[model samples]
Target: MKILFMLRDPFYEAYPTFIEAARELGEVETLYPDRGIEKAEIIKEIANTDILVVAKVKIDKEVIDAGARLKYIIKYGAGYDNIDIDYAYEKGIAVTNSPGQNAESVADNVFGLMLATSRNITKKDHEMKSNHWELSVGHEIYMKKIGIIGFGAIGKAVAKRAMGFSMEAIAYGHYLDPLAAKELNVRFVTLEELLTTSDYIIISTSLTEKNKGLINQNTIRLMKRSAYIINVSRGGLINEVDLMEALNQKQIKGAGLDVFSAEPPQNALPLLDNVVATPHIGGATYEALVRMADVTMTNIKRYLAGEELLYRVYPQEVRK
Candidate 1:
C-alpha cells in the first residue's frame, strides 16, 4: 500500500510520528509544496495512493478521480473545509480530522488577543519601543461581557479561561446545547445579540459557505464602538475589505486577527492604532503540533487496520 502525504510544509518536528505510522502501515511518500499545487499535479501524484494525508491543500473532484486506490484522507488539523467533501464522498473516501487536538492552545491565543486588544498592550509596547510611552489607559476584563461565536471545543476553552478574569460569557452556534451552556455558565444568544452586547468578541467558528464573510460591515456596525473583535478562527469568516473599512472609520474599536481572507495579502492593508495582526498562529504552538501529530497518526493507523477512525467525517455516506 502507498500513502501520499501532502503537507503545506515539512513538519520536521513531527516527522517521527509519520515515520512510525508508515512503518506500521505501508510506504509513505511525502510532498511539501511551498505554494499550493494545482489540481493537475495533485491528480498525477495521487494515481497510486492508498491513503492520503493532506494539510491545507485543496483536494477537489479532479484529484479524487485520479486516486484509484485511495481509501482514506486525514487532515492534520481540526478544519477540513479545504477538501471537497461531496467529491470525497462520491469517491468512497473516508475523511478524518484531529479536532480538539489544539483546542487549548487556540483558546489561549484567543484570550491573549482579547487581553492585548482590551488593554492596548500591543499599542503600548510599540509606543515604548519608539520612546513615546508615558502612561496609557488600558481596559480591564473584569465584569466585562464576552461573546464567543461557535461554541465548539476552542470556544468552550476560551469561555473557561474568561471565568478567571470574572468576565461574563455568551456564545452562539448552530449546535448549541442547553445542558452544555448551563454547565459552562455561558448564556446562549443569537449572533446579532452577541455582536451588539459583547465588550469582547472572539470568533472560533469553522468556515463554511454560510459562515464565509460572516463579520461584514453590517455585523460590525452592530458591535459596540469600543468593543474589540478577535478572530482565531478561519480567515474566510471575515470579509477583509469590510473589516478594513470598519477599522479605518472606527466602526468598531479594534480587531485582533490571526488569519486573513487572503493569507499574506499582496497589498498591505492599513493597521489602525487599535488593530493587531498575527500570522495565523492559533494552533502553531509546539505542544499543540506534537499532540495533533499524535492524534493524526493514531487515526491513520486505525484506518489502515480496518477499524473505525476516531474523528472520521462523512463516515456513513454511501460513495460511488
Candidate 2:
C-alpha cells in the first residue's frame, strides 16, 4: 500500500501511532495544508499511489486516472461526493468512507452554530470587545420547534441534544419508518411542514441528486420570516444565490452555515452580516480525526486479508 494523504491540514497530532503502523505496511506521503499545488501537480504526485486518502480535497476522474497504480480511496468522513465514484468504480478502484465516526462531533458543531446564531452570541461579543455596550436583545431557544432533516446518526444526536434545551424536535425523511421515528423520539413530518413550522431548521442530510439545492426560493418562502436555518451537511443543499436574495430582502431571519455551494464561496455569503459561516468544520474535532483513522485502518486490514471493506462507498448498493 503506497498510501497518499490528500489532506488540507494535519489531524490530531497527525495520529502518530497510526502513521507508524501504516508506514510499516507501505510508504506514506501527505500533501498538507499550507502549500499550494495545482491540479496538474496533484496528478503528478499521485502517479504511483496505491491507496489515496483524503478529507476535503476533490478527487475527480483526472486525478483517479493519473494514479496508475491506485487501488483504494479512503475518505476521512461520511460524505463521498467530492470523489468521482462512478469513474473510480469503472477503474476498479475501491472507495470507502468513515460513517458515524464523526457523528457526535458534527452534532456538537450544529448546536454550537445554532446557539451562536439564535442568541447573536458572536455579534454581542464583538460589540462588548469594541467598548460599545448597547443592549442587544436576542431570542430564547427554549421550547422552540426544531426540525431536523435526514434522520440519520447526526440527526438523532441533534434530537438528543435539543432535549437539554427543552426544545421540541421533529424530523423529516423520505422513507422514515414509524418504529424508527419512535425509537429516535422524533415525530415524522412532511418536508413542507418541517420548513413552515420549525423556528429553527437544521440541515443534517447528505447531498443526493434529488435534494441538491433543496432549500431554494419557494422553500424559503414557506419558512417563517423570523425562522433561522443551521446547515452542517453538504454545501450543495442550499442555493446560495437565492439565500443571498432572501437575506437582503429580509424574507427570513438568518443562517449559520458550516458548508457552502462552492467552498470559499465566490458569491454574497461573506457579505451578509446575519449569516455566520464557518469553513466547513462541523466534524474537524480531534476525536473525529482519531475515530475516522481507526475506521480506515480496519478497512486497510480487511483489504490486506482479502476480506470485504467496511464503509465501502462505490457501487452504493452493497451493504452487509
What are the clashing pairs of model 2?
none
- In model 1, what is the error at residue 80, expressed in angstroms? 0.9
Question: lDDT tens digits, residues 1-320, model 1?
Answer: 88888775646445556566665678878776655566677788899998888877778787888899988888888988888887787777888889998899999998888888877798888888999957877788888999999999999889888888888999999878778678878999999999999999999998988789999989998999988889988888988888888888888888888887776654344366777778777888778878877887787778767887887787224422
lDDT for model 2 comes to 0.86
TM-score of 1: 0.91
List candidate 1 segments past 4 Å from native: 14-17, 35-40, 127-134, 315-320
For model 1, what is the error of residue 36's alpha carbon versus the real structure, in angstroms, after optimal superposition?
A: 6.0
Scanning candidate 2 in windows of ten residues, the lowest lDDT window is 311-320
- How high is each candidate's TM-score? 0.91, 0.94
Model 2 ranges with Cα > 4 A deviation: 12-14, 175-177, 316-320
User: Best by lDDT, which number?
Assistant: 2
lDDT for each residue of candidate 2 in 1-320, tens digit (9 for 90 to 100): 68887776657355767777778778888776446668887798899988888887889988998999999999988988889888898899999999888899989998888888878888888899999888776788888999999888798889888888888889998657567567656898899999999999999998988899999999999999999989999889998899899988989989999999887788878568788888888888888888988898888888878899997785545432
